[model samples]
Target: MRADRLVSLVLLLRQHGRLSATALARELEVSTRTVLRDIEALSAAGVPVYAERGRHGGFELLPGFRTELTGLNPDEALALLVAGSRRGAQAFGLGSALASAMLKVVDALPESYRDTAAGAAERLLIDPETDLLSRRLVDEEVPDAIAAEVLRAVFAGHKLRIHYAAVDQTPMWRTVDPIGLVTIRDRGYLLATKSGADRTYRLSRILAAKELPEPAQRPDRVDLDRAWQERSTRFRTGGDQVTVLVRVNPGRREDLLGTALAVRAEEPDADGWLRMEVSFQDSRHAKWALWQLSMDAEALAPQWLRDFLRNRATAIATRYGVSS
Candidate 1:
């Protein structure tokens, strides 16, 4: 099992630019030694997976060695393209050299497969009005098996072993319970209650992870749905560095509190508004938050929040002749 996994790990990293041995172990559910042995196997097999030794080190394939993708049906071809389109979708098993390899596979296919591939091409475009990315990248795979395991580890009382990364982070291993997966199509993500506060992590950002059963699972009131929603609204387009502590209107407090955008920062007000603080990095994002509030919410703050809103009101008056 260990030796077989090493080969797969090598292929995984070779195909996907880099991964730490620890990350490989998490994905393979083995010890670090096992992953190392696997790497040794690859080196012996003429697959050049080199180790990057340092704070930034991880395994990467030797350049100029490209594997040819062969034996794909039309469904496989279509699946490859569509999968490549999604963030982190490439991990599903389409090798790294996707396009050129795909073309090669298509050329070798029976005429029927070619006809189907053409039909798929004509049938639909993934996103007609999608914003064109300056640089498009193929996402690696996140098998449903792995996804399901994460949920089990976090919500189902298990610990996770992961190959994880962060800004300036060297990919390393982690043992975290699957908290809950935060679905961001562009990137695979999760929210784990690691280090006390629940941390949201992009899945691909995590090189690998797995769950454990011992130490027991911690209890929480993490409504995955609510958390996901909260995460979505926590950012402002152009916002000031203020945490807008607001009391929702008496009539709308419950409804507002239920919303994903409503960050539950405090208690309900005597007037029935739920009091909470909304943090912003700058005035632009702050104004954007205020704009979202429309009439249902008000900013109760460090004076600046109110002043900003007032100025916004004045600007509105000056622009459209509404009120001063």
Candidate 2:
């Protein structure tokens, strides 16, 4: 492990030119004492490393000292190949570029690892379009022109203007300070700010986009993952959520949980079924999810929901000329 840490230390100094012990410790997730020991180890091992002392001083590697990428083991190489096989890059219009880079990665690998890594990657599948139930996964479509422009703005730190179509609303033009882009479950989103307020726009809903010349007024550094989580928490908690007590067959428990926002509590009933208190976004969401299970699930509480389901079922039966 220390060998890996020393290799990382050398690479970090090589890449960053110079880094303070505190900075190195932070990046390496170790203490300053550990960093000092690693630096001593590298120097003693014939690495041309030296230190500069001042308020802005740090450890630096001698110029012209570089390391090769041959240190990657078979497993690490395999992991990179498999991760690169994911289709997320396609959402950014970089599918072809990804393919080219992957070839280079495979070529750079040691001969001993090349065939094993490539064969392992070939055996793994990621994000197939259909599931075991033959249900198609939703892949939101974004025009290449629009995606490219949005990507440019986000990377360039420029304001962006877009013609966006919100749900049940007409398309309208708006300007936003581009923050970053996120892709989840094949759906792309633009995380930005409008008038100092956080805003997230689905990329598919962006009818058109333009990169503006003006610089964006955003923070120099951002934790996009934390920002997205906060927004998601707010959205989940702000909705007209409905909690339901339902009893479901054991075999269908996962199907019931798939659509639920949260499961408050669950226990096995004497009948060997699962009694779960589940939360949905609203009454409609609860109705739709429960309807999917048909006889396998039943709503136990909230007489209104039970009545609604009965009435709907009765109406359906009557339509087919059967007595309700």
Candidate 3:
């Protein structure tokens, strides 16, 4: 493990040119003392490592010193291959580049690992467009030109102007400071800031985009994952959410959960039926999801929901010429 740590330390220095012990420790998830020891070990191991003393000084490798350490074992190689098979890169218009990089990774792998990793990756499927019920997964379509312009702005840390269409609203032009891009369930979103206020725009709804020359005013570093999580939480809790107590067949538990915003509690009854307290966006959402389960699920609380379903079912039966 120390050998691995030393190798990582060297690579970090090589990639970053110089790193303070604190910075190295943070990146390695170890203490500053451990980073110092690793640096000493690398030096004793004939590595050309040196240090400079100043407020802005840290350890640096001598010029032109390189390590031939691939540092990847068979399992690591296999994991990379399998992850590369995902379609996420395609959303960014990098499908061909991903394929080329994967080829190079396989070629660089040890001969014994090369074939095995590739074969294992071939057997694993990810994010298929259809489910077992044969329901087609609808993917939002974004024009390549618009996506390219958005990507340029996000990566370049520039302002972006977009012609956007919001639901049931007129299309309008807006300028935003690009933060990052996120894709969920094949739907792409642009996280941005407008006049210092956070904004999220669906990529599919962007009719056009133009990258601005002005530099965006934003923090030097951003924790994008945290930002996205906070935004998602606000969106989920801000709406008129409805809580429903329902009894559902165990076989349809997943089907019910798929449409629920959150599940408060769940337990199995003596009859093996599942009783769950679930939250939906609103009464309409609850009704729509529960209705899909039909006889398999029953809403116990909220007499109004029961009445609504009963009336609907009765209407349907009467329409079919059956007595309700």
Candidate 4:
């Protein structure tokens, strides 16, 4: 680990030309003391590292010094840079490493493709904090230590003990055999099992974690995609599923389908509107999702859904009908 940190420190100085010990410490996620010791070690090992003492002083690599890295073609360079810009990897505690690796990648690229690829990457945004609709992305935090432990268990086939807080439930500790880790839309999930029963835990809800010495009680080899698909199918079917028939504006059909868990049936109406039967996790989920379309989509069946929406509309009218 120290070796990696030292290499990263050198790369940072080379790329930036000069950096203060404090800045190096922050970038490397270590203390200034460690950075100073690393600098001494590098210098002792004949690295061309030197310190300047003036007010604008810092550490710098010798002029013309460069480290060689694997050469990447244009497309390959661009892809790596784009991936490094995303926050998804942060959920697994690899944010800093990704950043450092990106730096090395850019520096290692051929001069012809380096600037152009980086410039193209800058114009392409993966997951902005807020989209054009002004919706903030939901990104949860996971402590670096906890994520590291989880990753260790998952990769090494070791059982893990975790203190988890499920939604609306008290925190409890459980020993699970971690199967794999999954990340979607910036949220991370641990696909594991307890007592041989399938279990899924949100990485954000892990309060603490411990790696166990015992080998994990999972299959020697797992097809993550198949496992995830099976779990998703079971979850969609076994939950308190509610179905509703709706007529929606043709233009907003995609919007309606996007919010629903699945569409059971769909057909075009005589009036050119879209008639569809959709499934939601529950009645409340159905109501919340349909309400978003407002006048554009109308729930036509499941009389209770219509009644609930009507009541909701009445309440909204009551609150805003009177202009203060």
Largest TM-score belongs to which candidate? 4
Higher-scoring candidate on lDDT, 1 or 4: 4
Write one digit per residue (lDDT tens) for candidate 2, span 216-267.
9999999999999998887677668888999999999989989998899999
Candidate 1 Cα errors over 4 Å, as ranges: 1-70, 84-105, 117-127, 130-241, 247-274, 322-324
Query: Candidates' TM-scores?
Result: 0.35, 0.68, 0.65, 0.87
lDDT score at residue 175, model 1, on the 0-100 scale: 67
Q: What is the lDDT of candidate 2?
A: 0.87
Q: Write the per-residue lDDT of candidate 1 for residues 1-324, one digit (tens) a residue.
A: 455455456556644578887887886678888778777877888887788899878889887555534577668877765644433333322233344344444444556666677568666666332456645544445655565556567666666887777756688876665555554544567766665655567765665556676643455656778877666655433223445677666666555444323353777777766677655656565667665667888877767768878897889878887543
Answer with 2 or 4, whichever has the higher TM-score.
Answer: 4
Residues 78-123, candidate 4: write the lDDT tens digits: 8999989999998898887788789888877666787788999988
Worst 10 residues of 1 by lDDT: 87-96
RMSD of each: 14.5, 16.1, 16.1, 2.7
Runs with alpha carbons beyond 4 Å of true place in candidate 2: 1-76, 107-113, 267-272, 300-304, 322-324
Of 1 and 3, which scores higher on lDDT? 3
**Which residue pairs of candidate 4 clash?**
none
Which prediction has more favorable TM-score, 2 or 3? Answer: 2
Give one digit per residue, the lDDT tens place, for model 3 in 1-324.
Answer: 677567667767765788899999997789999998888887888999999889999999997776332678878988888878777766665565576566556656666676787788888888887899999877677777888899999999999999999876999999999999887777788999999999999998999999999999888788889999999987777678888999999889999989998999998977889989989988888889989999999999789889999999999888999655
